[model samples]
Target: MLTDHHTHLAPDDDPLDEEALSIERIVAHVTAAMDRGLAAVAVTEHIYRFRVAKPAWAHPYWETQTQWDIDAYWEALSEAKAIGFPLLVGIECDWLPTGQEVLVEALRGRPWDLILGSIHWVDEGAVDYDLYSAFDHIDSEALWRGYVDRYARAALSGQFDVMTHADLPKSFGPLPSPATLGWAYDAIADALAAGGVCLEVSTAGLRKAARELYPSRALLERCNQRGVPIVLSSDAHAPADIARDFELAVEAAVAAGYSEVQQLKGRDRRPVPIG
Candidate 1:
């Protein structure tokens, strides 16, 4: 059965963006998953956008980033769940170095079906955006090294169930040398194997500059070699985006010799065989 483990609603409360914040949108999102033949879908908004998670975010944008009362998100999610839609609640939480207890405490006893560990930023700059857009400014090899090192640490932290986008640095442009990329993948695979964290295979990269799945072929192959579990996702932010490019994601998994994909219900993970 198809399962989309990552999704979001309104990025911000833009009055112009009513469709995203409406109950109609959440229902449509669930219907989209149904249309895609999904058995389950998770509405995993960014934890940094909610005031309850503010203490966990360690970015300069903390002061200026869009902050909304998280209760509205829960209300919408619960409404969708009550309708008997196969939707589940989740959050994409950053695995920052500090205040991890705060992040955990903020989410304690919440009805989360999954907690995706993510690395959206490295230091203060966004690794996938600013660093990726201007690859010439930084040492590509050094950047790759640093990101992988931190990713390994995040996986080993035991704070998340699934590690989101293991090879996110490849999203923009300017990749590291083949040797550097190989070693980084090795490190990530080793760390994931040790931590027992499921890897997220996101289709969003197809729409990004990467023009491929979140983890490239080489990295996925590494996971396969290490027998690391994997989860499939579209990383949808709107109804129309649910299960986007999912066929391609499955094809990539097949290419990596993976025949089973992971399904998450809360922290419990089950493997669904791919046909």
Candidate 2:
């Protein structure tokens, strides 16, 4: 079965808000995935959108952010589960070195199927969105190195089951320089190897301006070399986007030498061969 381990049940561009997220709306995304023949999906919402998580958020948008009812969230996911929807409740948690304690505290005692770690910011800038981007003003090389190091830290944190969009450095702005790549891949390979956290192979890149897959061929190869397994996802932001461009992702995984992808049942996992 093809399982999407990482995805968001939210509209693409608006500031993160829970009122816009609902079990019925998320189930619509799941229904769309069923049309694509996907057996299941993990709807991992952004944790920063929650008000209780306000202290951990560095994004300017969070300042105006007023709603964060995680109880309502669990209620929705629980509702879907109760009704037999092929869905898993999860969150895309930002892996920040400084916010480690706060994040751990915020997520403590919560029952979630998967907590996918994301490296959305390098310092104060967002790589993908222009509103919080630091690309134009900062040194590209420095940001890249820091981003790589940040992923390593996230993997070692033991707070996440999957690392979503493992190649987020190339998500926006210009291409990262080739000079520092050797060590960067090595660092990622080593971290994932040691941490046992699966790398997320996302097709969102194909939709990005870069038009490449996350954890591009070379990085995927490094992960393979280090014996790190991968999880496939589209990082679907809308109902129509569930499993979008997934055939291309399967091709990319096979080309990178991955014969199987991971499937998560709660926090537990097993391998499913790619056909």
Best by TM-score: 2
**Full-model lDDT for every candidate:** 0.81, 0.80
Writing each residue's lDDT as its tens digit, candidate 2 over 1-275 gives: 69887777775456444555665677687888789888898888777767767787666765455256777777788788878999888888888768667778877887788899888888887766788687866876877887888989999889899987877767676655676777788888899999999998898888887788888899898998888988888887887877888888888888888899888877888999995
lDDT, candidate 1, 180-239, per-residue tens: 999999999999999999999999888888888889899999999999999999888776
- Give me the runs in candidate 1 sitting further than 4 Å from their true place: 11-21, 131-137
Q: At residue 49, what lDDT does model 1 achieve?
A: 73
Question: Weakest 10 consecutive residues, lDDT, candidate 2?
Answer: 11-20
* Candidate 1 colliding pairs, count: 1
Which residue segments of model 2 deviate by more than 4 Å? 12-19
